[model samples]
Target chain A: MNEGETRKPIIVLVRPQLGENIGKAARAMLNFGLTEMRLVEPRDGWPNPSAGPAASGADIVLNRAQVYASTADAVADCAHVYATTVRKRGVTKPVVTPAEASSEIAAAQGRSAILFGPERSGLETEDVALARAILTVPINPEFGSLNLAQAVILCAYECSKHEGLVQPTQEDLLPPAPQEELDGLIAHLESMLEPKGYFRPEARAEATRRTLRGVLTKPAWNHLEVRTLRGVLSSLQREPRL
Target chain B: MNEGETRKPIIVLVRPQLGENIGKAARAMLNFGLTEMRLVEPRDGWPNPSAGPAASGADIVLNRAQVYASTADAVADCAHVYATTVRKRGVTKPVVTPAEASSEIAAAQGRSAILFGPERSGLETEDVALARAILTVPINPEFGSLNLAQAVILCAYECSKHEGLVQPTQEDLLPPAPQEELDGLIAHLESMLEPKGYFRPEARAEATRRTLRGVLTKPAWNHLEVRTLRGVLSSLQREPRL
Candidate 1:
């Protein structure tokens, strides 16, 4: 694996219940370039038949997943451990958002692991005690219902930002039209408006002109867009061909 | 709805296939405080029976969701429209990440809408043409397997960050123990270890002590933790009660 991949945090599901949820979690991890997965006493055990179909072709993550008997054994080699929890616990540990924890994991010296609890009950107090800090996703106060896979995807998504994932390119977007072309379009419209008595009230004409200029300038239309607008003005000026 | 809720971007599902996925998307949206959802020709039609069970108590979003006949009609009242797509398209619109799109939506005047296509096939070129910009989540190039709900959740999660969602409180954590308390705990451990020849070879004894000290100091144990460690050491020094 490359250096960036090595730095990626391992996703550990502590006592996860359903096989399908495990598969979904695997899909979520691989979506954002996280591959390593450790299962701490999964309820259905590993190599479940239901997992393959739910994984939706993310078998690599499931194939390489390691099963551990306990949470402590799962993160024995990790330098940093973060427990994912939604509700406020009475435990005394530093709580960090997924964004905060992801950045820290990216810069950490040794391997880091994020622990996710089971589908229904969430992490036991003893399980949470193993982590140095808590990772929480700030949700709506009235309604906070993030499923296991959803939580994993959010963390993986944030972590991908630090991995230097290539963003969608804007190369297709052309530069705005030159000043002369824009002036020409403005003049063409003014000429049409002049005969229609649009500027009849000369006292407020300058203000109206300024407002029109602001509306046109805000879009910063490229040459093609400018040409399209010019064609539109020409069509309006023409006698109905129909 | 409050000002922030009104300003929140509407999530438009275009020609969605499954009712379950639609319900899951609603749950995801509500988790991040997004209540507005618009459906454009769902395959099973509106009020699918499967939606309620899958929503998991996020009925508010589903109840208020508006149905439209076409993509254009769905975003007719919106001032800004963003299309969520995974693949690179030949379209020349500006492409942005969920983070960028959320921030823009948060600050934009008038209403904004984000369009998500069907479960199997993504946005048709014609559907995308109605949008002002394209929003794409940067994922693992080799393994892109984000489900419909997963995609909606990521966008909602990022948008929630701009909504001032309250972070998990760290009030439960106490400050690190005072220097004297830590020193006492270290000294107590050293006294026990000294008798066991743990600091062997006088020439390297200071280095060993420093390493020990470094290990203990890294955690920055609070006052209670230090006392607990001291108690453990004292207990170890005693004879086995059993």
Candidate 2:
């Protein structure tokens, strides 16, 4: 899909053993606005009461979650799937960070799922084989295991950041210069710098274009100031003697 | 190390179970420019033959690794230590993702290390007790085990990205305006707008400084041009026209 379409990640819980963990994962998913879920072999009943309270207000994930016996069934319609693991499991598939995976999932057609395994054993080695890439969390070597719900939260949070749900603290707040103004500024700069030999004969035009882009992209110049600068350049070009 | 000096992470493998995995971890660490490695209780001899072949030129990590017996001893001098795990080991510390962990680690003082565990049982519960915070990696629920070395690579990579290794994409590369030039510009701008009452007497100096800083920081004004503009302003300030 194009940038205009709203994108979300599908959280697939494979062989979840604890009802509370499932519920907690649901709650975490909702905390980041992720509701879609697919369940593969949940040991405890999906609608158990323990799950409801643990889910907080995330009943939506529980309500819409799809259940299956195998991971392949859950991700049948998914174009992209990532297997979560704390160990290598000897798979040769490409691995991606949660942020990268979210962007890929968002860009792909059809459904996508980030698969999770049981709390005790997690997914078997065979289960990870179905995924296109592996998702590994970076933790302390002394104690690297993470809670099931926590993993869900981590992925969900990364996906949310990638999807622009939260504004980054260091991002440039100013909007980029409009195309029309940028084009005019480029032309004006080229005309002025051309006579100054800023560009050699062979790569002159391309080099000039590159410099113009470099200057304008600095503060993302706005329309009025850009026009004023262009006017100054035009005047200079006309009155070469001055 | 203080905040400024703690931009990079010290990759630590605590009680690493396998030699090949250590090499693989080193390889991953190299991909992201992380060279430091601290080993806590390696099951196999470090700099093992198997590890070198597996490292694939991440020999820097292997060469620089410092080995210790206990996890606590390994990170004794570290101001911050994070344990990696797929499940919580009953530690009562804040849980943070590698991204968040890196930011905090970057701001912390003294050396830091992220601990990983042995292959079979992962990090011991006691080992996790020493960490100031717990790091959680987001993975697929169904396939949650990560290889020991892969874990090292992922965390190191994320930490490196925030430490200024990845330059900002903005194109302006002009030498920054000097402090004196910037000071002059601030003085000039304040005088230029003074007649219009842009800055009142009480807040004039502070407001002028802030505005100048904001504008100059945006485009990273050049030293020569800023002085020229300031010179023009000085002439205008001397005009004495109401």
Candidate 3:
């Protein structure tokens, strides 16, 4: 295999139930250029007919998938193994986000594999023990309901980024306003606040001015945004038209 | 609404098909803490019967989903509009990944909306024209097949990263060993190399030593790793057993 192909981490599904979900996971893997799949003791056995239709044309992933008798066997050749879990486990293994795992996997010297647990109940404690780290997706703590396929897709998507996917160009984003324009906007605002006694209390006036400057500077508003803010200040300064 | 709620981008499904898919999309959105959903003229009409069961308990999103007559009307209140497309279109709008769009939406001064096209067919030309930018997930060029729910989930997942989700801590990771330990390893390796005339040629000895140090310094191995290496060197120096 080529270096690029070898560098791609293997996706290992441990004790996955439901042929349809397996197929969905395959589809998710293929969507992000991940082709290797390893299955460990599937409940219904292999060659599940239901998986084909759900895979939606990602048959190649299913066709060449390897089956292992145990999770340890599945990751025997891999030097780095990460077990995915939704909840914080009692284990002391380092936890990482999918994005962070992808970066580490990319730089890893040897083969790397990510293990995903079954749908209903997640990975057994024994399965997690074989892994060097835990990979967790930081989701809404209140509504964390990521399915097997969704988890696979997210990990696959992040790994694809390191395979030379074209990054979205930032040319469309306008540069932050030049210093002079920002100064002008600040000066305009200060002028308005001075008359209204917004910066009153002569003893603390300097500190108040500095605080306002810090808030204005933090946004790094673009030239157009600065211009818009200037216009708003001018409008507010106008006499209300009855 | 509070600033956090206001900053969250609205997810708009334009001319969606299959009530089941709509329900799935709602589940996907709520998984990442996005509560607002807007639908524009769903194919089977609003309150689809198939949607509820497929949502998998993301009923809050489906129940609160707002239906609109047209795509334009759905995003009328938004200052920034992004239309998602799998393929590159003829439009000149800036194209961005989900992560980029999330960052922009988080920092935007006003409401932002991301539009997802229908299942079978994507956003129409008119819908593309209405958007300030195009949101595209960089997928496997050879096999691009992202279902509506998958697409929604990916975008939602990226947005959640900026919502103060507890980051996976790196406390388990050991810090790099102290410089003195690193120097000891280098010294031991150098002692072995000097006796073997590994750094031959007096003129180039300093340069070769520097190059060796560079390679060794890059990894910043921890104390345990350094100790392990020292053990390896000690083993190599042992006399071969008959």
Per-residue lDDT of B195 in model 3: 56
User: Model 1, A109-131: lDDT tens per residue?
Assistant: 89999999999999999889999
Instruction: Output the lDDT of residue A173, model 3.
Output: 55
**Model 3 over residues B1-242: C-alpha lDDT tens digits?**
68998888899999999999999998898888898999999999999999999999999999999999999999999999999999989989899999999999988999999999999999999999999999999999988999999999999989988898777776765777899998998899777667555556778889777866755675566776678567545644554322
Off by over 4 Å in 3: A165-242, B170-242
Residue B15 lDDT, candidate 3, scale 0-100: 96
TM-score of chain A of each: 0.95, 0.64, 0.68
- Can you tell me the DockQ of model 3? 0.14
How many clashes (backbone atoms < 3 Å, residues ≥3 apart in a chain or on different chains) does model 3 have? 0
lDDT for B94 (candidate 2): 89
Model 1 Cα RMSD, 1 decimal? 28.1
* TM-score for each of the candidates: 0.81, 0.41, 0.71
- DockQ, candidate 2, vs. native dimer: 0.04
User: C-alpha displacement of A197 in model 3, angstroms?
Assistant: 81
DockQ of 1: 0.18
Cα lDDT, all candidates: 0.83, 0.66, 0.83
Regions more than 4 Å wrong, model 2 = A1-242, B1-6, B168-242
Prediction RMSDs, each to the true structure: 28.1, 17.6, 23.0
